[model samples]
Target: MSFEFIEVADMSTEADYEPKNIFLTGGAGFIGSHAAILLAKKYPHYNVVVYDKLDYCACIENLNEVMDLPNFKFVKGDICSSDLVTYVFKENKIDTVLHFAAQTHVDNSFGNSFAFTQSNIYGTHVLLECAKNCPTMRRFVHVSTDEVYGEGEDFDAKPMDEEHVLEPTNPYAATKAGAEFLVKSYHRSFKLPVIITRGNNVYGPHQFPEKLIPKFANQILRGLPVTIHGDGSNTRNFLFVEDVARAFDCILHKGEVGKIYNIGGCNELPNIEVAKSLIKILGKEKEMDDYITYVPDRKFNDLRYTITSEKLHKLGWKEEMSWEDGLRKTVEWYKTYTNRYGNIENALVAHPRMTGTSPTNI
Candidate 1:
């Protein structure tokens, strides 16, 4: 089945008569880029302004396709900068805000919890403050992750729901959980029109190669060994970037205020199985058993993270891409990057903080 990308025109006029002016943070990142593109294409009548810090995790190339679109504009700035964020709200006349910028690497967060707190916690606070002050701001959609629910080993059938107790394991998840609280607090005390979405691991094109799936795909395509943290039995639920993007559109347009939605995939696989699947898709199955190497796991690595997105599904959101299909497309995209870019050594150097911390060190 083909996926239906959401546009601004799709929102009912009864909710808000004028064409919406959207302010999106982290619009150049993986999932944000896709969402921006979909919004631009699907909602030709609306104006979409993107504000991003363009950190190591982001690239302007991600927005190349939508850069020239009439309704889309990008502003290079940080979310933590109150002056900059406030200026964006005032200058753009933004009707809604989609907050997506955050420090997301769990391992890195363990080494420097300060960075996570600054970006995830402080950055969110800045945006929330701006939205609260903007009388024109009708809604605020805060994007988050399922890692806030921590880990569990129940592979048989216990999926985390929206009501699940938050038990964040690492610094990254901890910071995100903190941010969620702040959003909720603002909604209750200040009456900010806010909603939150916690999703599973997201994979897709334009993703920086630090995460598991893309990292492994890039390495395997270059005939390099793949690293599996710990015994590789740890499992995670994966969602395609576009699916997560579409879920955001649903939440922004239809999700109830002061409510949190869990967006996740139906498929759950162990890390080792994920590696083997990539090998098969790359036609390197013979090297699957041999090319795999076990790296020491990160500090406080969660054993499993699964989510039940029934809340999002009930709100007319669904995962349209299957794991196999999504994996195939991801592999193809990474292959192109490898061939065109030659090597991403410079990109690695730019993000030195990522190299810090490992089970081998602490």
Candidate 2:
């Protein structure tokens, strides 16, 4: 299960990086979609090829702003398909690959662990296999999660750095860590010019309702109960998707190869506080108790995931969106724009683990 480690290849730095065409797996999902839009519009010369399976969390409408762009192309395909992934790289003459496709929900991973392993590990392997064969490839940016560092429950503890030990607590985080190992192997063995990013909890528009902010925002907007796991003491550093998009752009253009970067948000808030913020935004603070519900926690829920992003900051990337602005923008979008899942009731559940349901096709 290992690729042979070999000498590093002649690669390009920030100024030397000449991206002919860019490839993004899961380019229609939350963070992926935002990145697609930013990359496509910002670099109109670089052909942006979006290869997405259009999973439950993805919607073609998410890329509506860039749909008509001449440089933006969308292909409905899975990263696990070696043939398709290979064909895309060869046909597009792709030099940059941003791997974002994965089963990324922790709650669902409890019951649907295999899907996580398959998408997060094996699927990533398939993409790496194809990426290694491309002579034109200069960058393979693997978008990972800070959860792979596992629990940093102590809010006051020193934030984990890029070299921090990988200690995943749940099935989802374990699979993500496994995928990171594969990405690193490719960089070491084949000199694939790889960069890995461990980003914190990302929120903003285009996010699926299954996640914390969107789920609670949806519930509060609908006058439904905002379900909180346990006593809602679990804290997460929330980053705006736009900021994350900027971070990816900076990394793609200037990040050092063979290095790992942490994309973190300055704001860290407990689950209860976040829920309350959304409630207040919806003008329902008076009925906060009625609009909120307590649910049993997962078998293992980490209180916090602390990671430093000084490395990314050195690349001239910083989070610009404040918590209040980001949360307000997210809630406002979900309130008016409806019709992604049709009956998003399943997504708004306490712990959505719906398997085999057909995802959208872009």
Candidate 3:
């Protein structure tokens, strides 16, 4: 399909005109997929080009809902390729870029930091370079994680704010932190219009089975044991995927250039409790306790990590879904996916729980 350039003001002449032609990296992944759909619905007049590498975690099935949308376009490419990224910006006439492409699994990051560094750090540099050269680009939104602030077990009583110093404990977070630095540097040195957002743990539909929540949900649905690392006391603030997507939309539309915003859900729960809650939702309460099996902890499992979305809230964006309702919907979606796809294990190679430093692990 040919790329179409859209003028934001054409959507609604009465509303303030926002620039269009959004270029989204990793738009096929779980959160990115939802973001693309939401963007299409909100701005039907604007064109959305999705650039994805189709990595292990990314699935085209996530885009089924928006496939027929005339404004949506999909491009198969890697963000780390400077030439490819540059070509995309020029060909699509992209005015805004939402960078969500990265190796995000912490366990996988520990096994092979190389991919994380290449994709998260160098890829970000490549995107920044493209944006620097693209005269039409107005906003470059860099999506990051709260893990950059490091182990927050000590601060469990309070939420971490944007000013918190980065003390990443894993390769994944380290590389993400590096990417954030690169974006900020580009904004300062080259005067690139960039905004950074760091959000807390996100869980929702279309998540790959490797992630904790989905993995456990899949196991429970299959009548398998849900593995809990080190008694599952680790706590985290969970944000719904849609809420995270909305946060990105808010940043793209209203965020100030060169600013960093923290997006998080006020909902916090321990890992064990979350698993138990899922069990209850599945109506397998009798097997709930039995389904949870304590496993060895990862090399450096952060006890807790939380973020305060005060800045994002001030921007007139707030999380609307309750944890209870979101969890119910998430569980139901996984059930449906499982029914259609059969066992998740059969669909993809299951990565072993991080146990040792074997080269092939994760």
Question: How do the residues 1-362 of candidate 3 rate in per-residue lDDT, one tens digit apiece?
Answer: 21122222322232223658999888888889899999987889889998988776777788898888999999888887889889989998999898888888887787788878888898889899989999898778899988998987675357778777888999999999999888877876777877788988889997877777888888888888788878789988888999988988877777776667898888889889998998899988987668878887888899898778899998789999999999999998987786433345732223443321211101
Q: Which residue pairs clash in candidate 1?
A: 7-42
What's the candidate order when arranged by decreasing lDDT? 2, 3, 1
Cα RMSD for candidates in order: 6.3, 2.7, 6.6
- lDDT tens digits by residue: candidate 2, 57-113: 888889999999999999999877899888989999999999888888888789988
Better of 1 and 2 by TM-score: 2
Residue 269, candidate 2: Cα error in Å is 0.3
- Name the better of 1 and 2 by lDDT: 2
Query: Best-fitting candidate, measured by lDDT?
Result: 2
For residues 24-79, could you state the per-residue lDDT of candidate 1 as single tens digits? 88888778888888888888988999888777667778888889998999998878
lDDT value, candidate 2, whole model: 0.86
lDDT at position 13, candidate 1: 31
Model 1 spans with C-alpha error above 4 angstroms: 1-19, 339-362
lDDT at residue 111 of model 1 (Cα atoms): 65
Query: Following a full C-alpha superposition, what root-mean-square deviation does model 3 have from the true structure?
Result: 6.6
lDDT of each: 0.78, 0.86, 0.80
